[model samples]
Target: MTDQPPPQDQPPTPPVPPGNPQPQYGYPQAPPPPAPPQPGYGYPTAPQHPYAQQPGYGYPAQPVTVVAGSGGDTRRGENRTIALIILAAVVAIGLIIGSGVWYAGSSHGGGGTAGPGGGKNGTATVTGGKEKVPANPAADVLFKVPQPKTEDPSVPTAGSWLSGRVYAKSGIAEIIGYDPADGTKKWTLKFPGPVCAATERVTADGRTGIVYQPSMPTKTSRPGCTQVAAIDVRAGTELWSKSIGTGEFATQFRNVTVSGNTVAVGGSDGGAAWDIGTGKVLWQPKPGDGCSDAGYGGGPKLVAVRKCGTYGNRTLSIQNVDPTSGKVISEYKMGAGIEYAGIVSTDPLVVGADAGHSASGGSGVSDYFSIDNRTGRLLARIPVSGDAYEGECDTISQVEECKGVVAGDGKLYLATKERNEKKAHGSTNEVVAFDLATGKQTGQRAAAGDSFALFPLRMDGGNLIAYKKPPYDKGGQIVSVDGASFRSTTLMELPAAGADRDLQTDFQPGYSEYRYTQGKFFMAEPNVGKPIGSFDKDRNLFVAFGTRD
Candidate 1:
C-alpha cells in the first residue's frame, strides 16, 4: 500500500481508521505488524509524508518553445542583453523558487544533430561481476530494507555506495552493508551521531570519506559536524577517524570528498585535507584577506571554489589545486554578481551558476561555464535556463552534488523538461547534448517514447546510461544510449505488476539515489522521515531488483 500527502494548497486528510486492510505489493502474504516505534528526534505533531511528489523540482505543467541557436561563441553584446532579461524577470517575479516546468533552448544554435556512426560500444563494468545487456531483459525483487523509525520528520541519512559484493546504506547513526544477491546483513558500522555529509565517489581501493558529529544532539546541547573519517566499504571497517580542535573552536564542515589519497572537507570554517592512509593533516585553512575556500570537488581531479569580498559584492575564483601540496595549478575568475558556483566536472572543469540571480526554479543554474582547466582560459559559456532543463545542484555549500546532468566525452548531456505529447495522451521527454568546445547543441537526441521521462544516470565508456520513468501501470527501464549515434539499448526491465512495481515507482529519480551494476538495480532513499500513520509503517528504506531470480 502507498500513502500520498495532500497538495501544498490543500489541508491534509485524516488518517485511515485501524483494521482497514492495506494492499501489500510484491509480498505474497500480508506484511508483518509494525515494529515498535524507535526512539529518535523529529517533531511531536502529526507526521508529514515524504513520498508525495513536490511541485518545484520535477516536471512542469506546460511546455514552452526552445530558443534557436547556431552553435559557437555568443557575442558580448548578445550576452549582455540575455543577462539583462534574466535580471528583469527575477525582479518582476520576486525570485520564485520551486520545481516548475519551463522550456529552454540555446538561442545560438538549432536543435541537436546526430553524430557519425562507428562510435564505441557501451559496457557495464562492475567490481566483482560483468553485466551484459540481455536479449530479453526482465527483473525480480532481490531484497528490501524496512524504514527505520524516527520521531522527527527530517533526519539526515544522505549516503550510499556499492563496493565489491556489498551494498552499503546509511541510517540514523549507523551504516549497514548487505549481500547484493540476497537481503542478508553482512556488517554494520555505527557512529556517535548522524552522518552530516558524504561523498558519492569511492576510491580504487574501496575507501570513502564521511563527516559526522562527535556525539548525538540533545535538547540542551547540539554538536557540530566536526569529525571526518575514512571507511573501507568492502571490508566494513574504519581505517582512520580524526578531527581538529574541539568545543567552540572546532572547524565545522558542510561537505566532504575523496580525491586520490586525500580526504578533503570544507565549509564556513574554510577548508582542510587529510591523508587517507595515515590520517595525517595535509593542510589547514589560512585566515586572511577576507577570502576563504567554500568547498572542493573531487573525482579524477581536485578543484576548489574560493569566495572573497564583502557580503553582496563578491568575486569567485575556480582553482585547480594539487591534492598533496595544496598548490593552485590554474585559476579562472568569474564575472561580477555571480555569488555562488557549483562544480559539475573537474577534468573538463564545468561550472554552473545563476548570474544576477536570474534562475526561477530551484535548479541553481542559469548558465554553464566550460573552462580550460590546464590554462585557466574560457572555452564556452553554455546558457541553460532552469525552465527548459532538468538538472539540479546545491548552490549553497555542497559544491559537487549536481544531478540530472552528465559531462563526458567532450560534451554535456541534459534531459529536457517533460512535455505533453501532441498526438499521444501521456507526456514524454528527450535527452540532448551540447558541445563543450562550441557551446552548440549537437543535434543528437534520445527520445523517451510515449509516457516516459528520460534522465541521464552516468557515463559507461563512451555510452550514456539513463533511466526511463514508467507510467502509472508500467515498470521502469534502464537503457544504454550510444554516445555518438544516439541509439538506445535496453539493459534491464523490472516487473510491471506486484510489489516490485510499487517499490520502483515509489523512489523517483531526482529524489532518490540509484545504482545499477552487475545486472542489479538498487534504489535507496537519501533521507527517511517519520511514517504518516500505521499504514505507512512498512515503507522500505531501500529496495533491490535483479535480472536473475
Candidate 2:
C-alpha cells in the first residue's frame, strides 16, 4: 500500500449521548491513543497528496522560445591576434593528425581545408578511437577574466559565464560580472549576505540574467537561507527577489538552476519555484511536505524525489511536476529498502540508487536506472559492472564532475576503472558504450597508455573528448573518440605547467577541471598550493582551447 499519514482524530467521541451516559459512568472509557509524535526535523512522516494541475502562474499559454548566444574572441591588439593565428597553424600541422576521412572534390581531401586558425572546414571520420584535432587550441584564449577584489577571497561562488563573454564570479558579499575579452568590469550585484550558488543563462526575452541564493551568516541559526534573487546579466541590477519561508539549514540547499524562464531552488526542508522574469512564487512545498530538491527536467517537466518511512525501510517518490504551476503531474514509486537516490540526468530521467555500499569494501557500486520522465515508468536498469576506482562515485553534481559518464548521440558512455595486475599501484581505465534504449553494452575500449586513466570530458561535433587523468604533467594529452566507430586519436599534449607541486584534488574555483562549452574547451589551472601569496599572486586562469572562429 502507498504510505500515507496517520488519519486525523475524530472530534473527541462526542460526550456520551444521553442514554449511554449512565452506562459510561459504570464502565471506564479507554483513554485516546497518543497523537503520533509531531513530524521530526520538518520532514513529513506521511506522503503528500498529489496536487492537480492548474494554470501556471505568470506564464504564457504556449512555451517561450529560448535563444542561445554566440561567443567570439575580441582582440586586445591586431598584432597579437595575427601572431596567435600563425602560431596556431604551425602547431596544428606539427601536432595534429588527420582522422583520414574527407569531403569529395577537394585537393586537401584527406586533410580537409585548414582555416587560418587551423580548424578543419569539414568533419573527419576515423575508426579505432581517433579524433580530428585543430592546430593551436591556445590561440583561442581571448583573455583571462580575473576574479574580483574582495575583503574575504577565501570563498568564491562557483563561477559561470554567458556566451556573450560576460563572466561572473562571487565573493562573500557580492557577485560581479566582467568582460572576458579585455578584463573590463561589466557589472556587480551585491547581496545582503553571502552568496551560496549562482547560475546564469540567456532568457526568452533575449537577455541574460543570473539566479543566486544567499547563505546565512551563522549556519547553526535556523532559517539561514530564506531568499533568492534574479539579477540582470548585462545591467548588473536585481530584477526581483523572493523569500521562501522554509527555515531550512543553509547547507542543505543546492545551487539555483534556470530552465527556460523558470528558476528552481531546492533545500533540505523543501523547494520553491519562481518565474525568473517576474518575482512571482509559483508553488512551494508546504510545511510537513515530504518533497524536497525540486529541479527542472526536459520540457515543462519539473522533477523531484521525496522520501518517507523510517531508517531501515524507506520509499522514494519520483515526482514529475508541472514547471510553471508547481502541480504534481505524475508520480512513480520505488521502495523495498531503497534509502538514497541521486539524480544523474533528467531528460530521460536517469537516477543512481545507492545500494548501501560503503566506500571501503565490496563492489561499492551504484545502480543506474533509467525512467521515462513523461510516463513515470521504469525503462531499464543498467547493472553496476565497473569497479569504484577512477570514474567512480564522487559526490553528485552530475556531468560536471563525473565527466566519465555521458549521454550523447543516442548512446550512453561510461568510463570504468579496473585493478591492473601488472601495475604496482593505479588501475586501468576503460571506456564502454551502451545503447540507451536497450541497456546493452555496445563496445568497450581501453585508454592507449596503461599509466594514465582516461576521463571523458564532453561531446564535441558528435565526438567524445577525453583527457588523461590528473597530475596532468607535460606528458598528458587530449584525445577525441569517435561516436560511431569508438575510435580514438591523440589530439595534442598539454602545455607545460609552471612547475610540479602537490596536485590539488578538490573540485573548486582554483582547482583544476576540464570544461567544454560553445566550441571551446577550458582547463582551469590555479596558482594555489604554490608559493604565491594569499592575495597578490593567488591567480586562477582558464586556458581556453578553442576551434577556429
**Which candidate achieves the best lDDT against the true structure?**
1
TM-score per candidate, in order? Answer: 0.78, 0.62
Cα lDDT, all candidates: 0.66, 0.41
Model 2 has a clash total of 9
Instruction: After superposing candidate 1 on the true structure, give the runs of residues whose Cα lies further than 4 Å from its correct spot.
Output: 1-131
Q: Could you tell me the TM-score of candidate 1? A: 0.78
Kindly give the stretch of ten consecutive residues in candidate 1 with the minimal lDDT sum.
Answer: 80-89
Query: How do the residues 194-305 of candidate 1 rate in per-residue lDDT, one tens digit apiece?
Result: 8878888899878899988778777776677888999889899988988767777777877889889989987765677888888878766553335566788888888877
Clashing pairs in 2: 92-135, 128-487, 128-488, 129-487, 129-488, 129-489, 130-487, 130-488, 130-489
